[model samples]
Target: MVIGDGILTPCISDSIVWISAAILVGLFMVQRFGAGKVGYTFAPILCIWFLFISGIGVYNFIKYDPTVLKALNPKYIIDYFKRNSLDAWISLGGVILATTGAEALFADLGHFSVWSIQISMCCVVYPSITIAYIGQASFLRKNNDLVGDTFYKSIPGPVYWPMFVVSVLAAIIASQSLISDFLHNPTIPLSRVLPLCEIVHTSPKYAGQVYVPEVNYILMLACLGVTLGFRTTAKIGNAFGIAVVFVMSITSCLLVLIMIMVWKSSLLYIIGYVVVIGFVELIYLSSVLYKFKEGGYLPLAFATILMAIMLLWNYVYKRKYYYELNNKISPERLKEIATNEKICRIPGLAMFYSELVQGIPPIFEHYVKNVPAMHSVLIFVSKKSLPISSIPVEERFLFRRIDTDGVNVYRCVARYGYRDARSEEEPFEKILIERLKDFIREDLAVNEGERLEAVAREIEVLDQACFSGVVYLIGESEVVAKQGSNLVKKIVIDQAYNFMKKNLRQSNMMLDIPHARMLKVGMIYEL
Candidate 1:
């Protein structure tokens, strides 16, 4: 909408709206090629935007209203509030838009260094925005008739067209940052935090730089819908203001928690921080809330829907994890089953993908109990998510032998960082086999003199068996309400959870396992 307004002011054409939509669609369409390709192009344009605005601000500040500088004094703010209390407070909703890109700067910290951001904001962004606002106030003081389009009308005739072009470019660049953050940030309940799309990391150097084709198209369609629906920048600005204030208020609350828990700050410092920031945010929040009937309800409605989805997913996942924790079989039980002579031993290898790092998964026990037979080599592989950016290759897999009985049973834990890419080129089975081979070689080397011949023969037999075939077993578990449960539990577990599970990507597809050699052990969990 900002871009459309910019173009419409300078170009007197009936098709400007369509042109703006086309440009917005084009911006999203190029996202699949990755942000790194075009991110550098925005820097120079943004620099020019800041410089141009600062120059105009200085010119207007000197010529129109030198006395407008006195408005910066806090005394005037206090007097205005004293005279028109509620009106002054309601205008804060508009005041907060002046710092519009602050949150985006914080979100982009993963792409750039903290020092770089600090320097840019202090030297470039802060001074430019302050001067631009003062100049706009000065211009409005002299010419009240130009209040509707103060920004463009205040510009000098010679540079008006060029400034309009710059404004359009700036708007597009700002919108790009917002869309990128929405799709990339895992904390936002849009892409990674929800099962809305598959986030594919395009840059090996920067894990935060991702490309989500599904989200990109969805956002583009949404942009077009809003552009056609609202058809004016004023209504869109109201929605945008609500979104900005909500984000600021949420950030302030999260910051208070972080300072206490992560920073371990003093009580006095925490109180001071909250009092200062909380006061400002509360005023803006109230002001935006007051405008709920005038388009502010849109963002609040969207947030409510997103929050419900994230909470539902988290609830279902917790219930499933609790079930696994209670129903897991002990290692002794697995050993006894492996040692049982009555049960037949199959010829090939079986890799059971489980979530539990300790104890055998209930799916494995359920399978063997029904079949009364197990593979010659059984591996319980658990893929664990770590809290770091990337895990070292050498520390990727932790292999431990469970028993040395009739069938060689082992447990393998594969560690991955949240930011790490699960490359589809390397199948999990192939990686597991390579790690197992490495484990055998290390074992043989460690016990070179004690059981050299026995270890060599065992390695040869295991190699032949692994080469013969490998099967992947995964649990296709569903959460359901227990018998005699209440309606809410049934609706949440049996209806909502099951619906999401059926739509979300399956474990085998996510792990890149071949469908032909995969076996799904279906199970039901009543919680």
Candidate 2:
């Protein structure tokens, strides 16, 4: 029997396990919210957990016999490998399973300063884990025939329960941090900017993280299975640690490559990064090879599936966007449009805004069909939002002037925040009004401020005029007929029409009015 095998051992208690799990989950939430918010509170809890575990490790280290230190020699690893090459490799596979979540380190980098994570790893995690490993080696030395999770069972009852709980919590927080990272930080911009990157209105919130409810729940389930399915620490540890090391090694290499490309970095920086990466990779790889066959496949399979899903989802989504984006207006066409508007002949300006920056937008067809009378047009192409905000008033709503034949073609756009009292001043509808005022003041020799006020009044009057007439499109009306008039369509149309009507009235801008010839355009397809 193992020397520590008695009723006083910690493995006999279940309550400590649950407590540890709860604390770890709480800390995980802290990490998820970010250090600025909940991390401070979580720090103490994490510290306590680490201290308690570290104490146990230290106790074992101090009590162990001196002979156990021999295992630290490089010859032990070399000799063991020669004697049991296949077994060693298989054990390493298990260690690879242990480190499965190591990839999350990069993902969680945003939550804390890089310095903090590195500090925590060096000062807390690495030291404690190494101490524990050393203690395990000591325990094995005292009992050569011992197997399985005997290392954990060797602890005194007072320490056993607390350690078990700590292990459970550590596993959970490690997994959850990865999920939160993906949700909050995606890798790409949500959309393109107009003319320049500066034209982008707002930065994407989730620049590197993604939130997939299905994946989250699946991970939770898997974690629970592993917890209950295999109740021993050593068994799970062997399989769980290797994957993290592999991911870390790969990312380290990737980081080095990225730095070289970005900075044309010095050889010293390259070498330093390589050494650190190499060390961690080597350590993890060695550990994994030490324990592969028992249960390493569990985390390996989990990571494989995770990566596959991420890649496949991105591929499918990108394909759909690319298909829709393929149709675009060329630079030559824009130049031709400028020429056709007679910028040399026009009196004012023609201002334009394209919500979609990738190509000439679907709305350009509307311009071709209407062919409004204008002199010079200054087309200000603007980017589009996904579904268009419902705000009543917006600065971008101002008017713009397009130059054509020296005459000005005025085009106004309105950008609204949403359907609320605040939206009245921010509507997209005022883009045209602002542009027209500027043209009148600068080009037409009108008082800048007074002319803008007058133009606003005129826009109000024209909008009132539109109330008397109905706005309609000209060609290809057959498609709406074929789509079938269902309850959902009716409900959507009614809501949209009502929303638009309310906003237009509030802005004093109507879509159709008397004597204004409610502008008609060609067929409409999915824009």
Candidate 3:
């Protein structure tokens, strides 16, 4: 099924092929090692590529012959349009090629500051491109030939080869970057998460920068198909341009909604962003729509498929995540875990294990039945995956510890990402403790063969300040009873039997009704 170059006649130029190869190789290296540095290197190189093309475009424009110009006037553009309006619509299939690269811009926001991207666009990309496009216009008028081929021939010596190489590679890199943006930012912040609030919240890790493998692969295939199938830049750009404009148009609409109702700010902000996006989209749309007869439908068809996939994937992933979380809460087990605690002789200390931190749990009512006098200090324990490799101080601040009426409640919550949690064999608590020790000892420096007694001694001091007199583990009922405890031990165990019955295992509520003895209610809070 090898189609000869006959179908792709215009790509016979060795120079163009060589340039494209260089651009591809350069980007691959950049993607691997240039995460934070891409903007500095990439933006400048791209700007140069744009300027070089624009310069050729401008030169071609100024030197257009008068006779040739007469035939290529607006009439030719209109006639070509009118004669094949339907065909032009079909050609829109190719428009997908242009916007395929736009996702990369969003993905790279973290790598480069927003201001840096803007600066590169203004200083290098825009002006150079303006000149080249003008040259393209002029060249078209004089030669009555395919504009891409004309521009290629006009380049002096080997310069054409390098320019071609740069242009194609830059285009592909740009495409890959856009795909990355979508994977990292899944939520519709203003509309879904924070509709009433003006400011949107995001963790530093979930910032606008992201990479999407699916989108990248799809784009690669689409771009390769267009390149090998058509061989002429003009034919590809026509279709690519339309798809780019369509995506831009949708993005503009979303941005406007965010600016108006979501942000609900002033008119100046709205108009400025809208106008810029509008102008760019309009230009591309005009190009693709006008060239419908040549080739455009190819991109439009591909873009429609891509957008549908994006919408569906987000919906399913979020739903499954929440479902598993709610299923883990247990009432009966939480009660058994909370009740078996040892009341310390130390006056202010209180230690008990219960899965209930938030909402109604059996442990809260149990405190009312057993001990009328609540202990002054409370320690709540939870089992989760290991601590983060490096816990940023900001992440540590997420927990709130407070003292009320000589009683201290320490509520500990643990977290684990999907990769580590999916392993079936290992117990979570052991992994969690190891992680905590690693985090606490992260900065300690000692020879590998040397004992960690000195570091351990220092860490114990810090731990005493944090862990001190009473420590409780909220775990299973069987584990709590079998562990064996008396008043002497500072540690308290909570099997969380009630919590397991209520939340996780879902037991009958009537069992605790008749003999229901409620204890002095401790702090009532929900997770």
Candidate 4:
């Protein structure tokens, strides 16, 4: 209804849907190149866009009716509400569309400073948008018949083509901003072998730059479906309006809590903010929801499905964590492994991956019970993310040696910051081995003759094992709900969660974890 149709381009016929679908596919295809590069390319075009809109706005305002500025007073708001009553309230559904991408400006703040966004919003965005709308209203007064194409139709013919090109770019950028934030919620489960940090990390220079292929393609499909389904900007705008006001409403509530708990602001100030901003957003939300059947339900439906999955996953995640913690191998089990006559010691190094931070995971017990063999040089690797931005290189690996009667068993806890970018398997393995050697050099280089001899022997064994090659034993856990569990628990764990696990089998190739060199130890946990 906008670009390929007469609203923006008159000659393109009814192919706006396909044109939109093409642009959307292109956007998703390029996301893997990282947002930093994409934004850098788009930034200058955006600058040109604001200038174009502002210039056109001023031109129309002056030529058509400069006197329309008189309607800017607050009294008109009161007068209009009084004259139209409920009709005026219903108009908010359309009016809210003006503020559609406002929240995305806040979401992308991590990529830019507060001052830059503030200056841009205040100096450029605010004034340009105000003037453009006013100019559009002025143009409407003179050319009322062209209300639908008021934006494109009002442009002076000489610059109309350039403005059309700018408008298309602007539209995509607007959607891209919101889609960046949309990719985070209810993220699909990733493979145990694939680190969380690698899923979206795309840029080498910027820690925040991310492009999750799973989420990006899913969003692209959704956008294309909406384009084909809605087939018109009017219906799509209805959905857009609801999403904007709904986010604003939620932001308002979150602000109050943040003010009270985080900021420790005054109650009076909170009340004032709520009364002013909260009441207005509430009105917009109520009015927009009236169009629920007319495409307003898209956001609601999307949100509902995501929320359901998140809830189910959260329940199952907690259950699985407790099960692991409760059934972890005891310290005595480590000593028994070395003493047992039937337990065979293998040649190469074995790296067992688990969720446990301290104790050995039960998967080892399950493995040993079945095979009756263990590796000569054992290293338990637990890679987990901590609640921070980035961890120092020196502090990343926490090493602890287990005194298990010459079993040469050690525990390595690899800590990562939530925002840290974990690269390929080779780098990860290289770093861990270096850090392990460093640990031995620092802790085991004692003055005792026996201790020194033991340290030398241990290093020799490690070298021999590494030369023989290494195997990664990652646990493939299956969580089944206990018979005594409730209906929801059973449904969530055995049905919804299990189904997601099965289908969410991402290729370990992305992480460079060679499937041939890795062995998955299967374990069933009834939680």
Question: Which regions of candidate 2 are displaced past 4 Å?
Answer: 1-41, 96-103, 143-146, 190-242, 265-355, 363-527
Relative to the unseen true structure, what is the C-alpha lDDT of residue 18 in candidate 1, on a scale of 0 to 100? Answer: 79
Instruction: Give the TM-score of each candidate.
Output: 0.90, 0.56, 0.49, 0.90
Candidate 4: how large is its RMSD? 4.4
What stretches of model 4 exceed 4 Å from their correct place?
1-15, 184-198, 385-396, 415-431, 506-511
Model 4 earns a TM-score of: 0.90
Expressed as tens digits, the lDDT of each residue in 29-91 for candidate 2 is: 333343333444446666767787667666766776546677778998899889997777556
CA-lDDT, candidates in order: 0.75, 0.47, 0.44, 0.75
For residues 149-259, write the lDDT of model 1, one tens digit per residue.
899988988999999999888877777777666655454434223654566665656666778776677667767766666676666666777777777777788888999
Is 3 or 4 the stronger prediction by lDDT?
Answer: 4
| Model 4: lDDT of residue 225 | 70
Q: What C-alpha lDDT does candidate 1 achieve relative to the native structure?
A: 0.75
lDDT of 3 at 27: 40
Q: Lowest summed lDDT over 10 consecutive residues: which window, candidate 4?
A: 1-10
Q: Which wins on lDDT, candidate 1 or candidate 2?
A: 1
lDDT of 1 at 350: 87
Model 2 earns a TM-score of: 0.56
- Model 1 clashing residue pairs (backbone): none
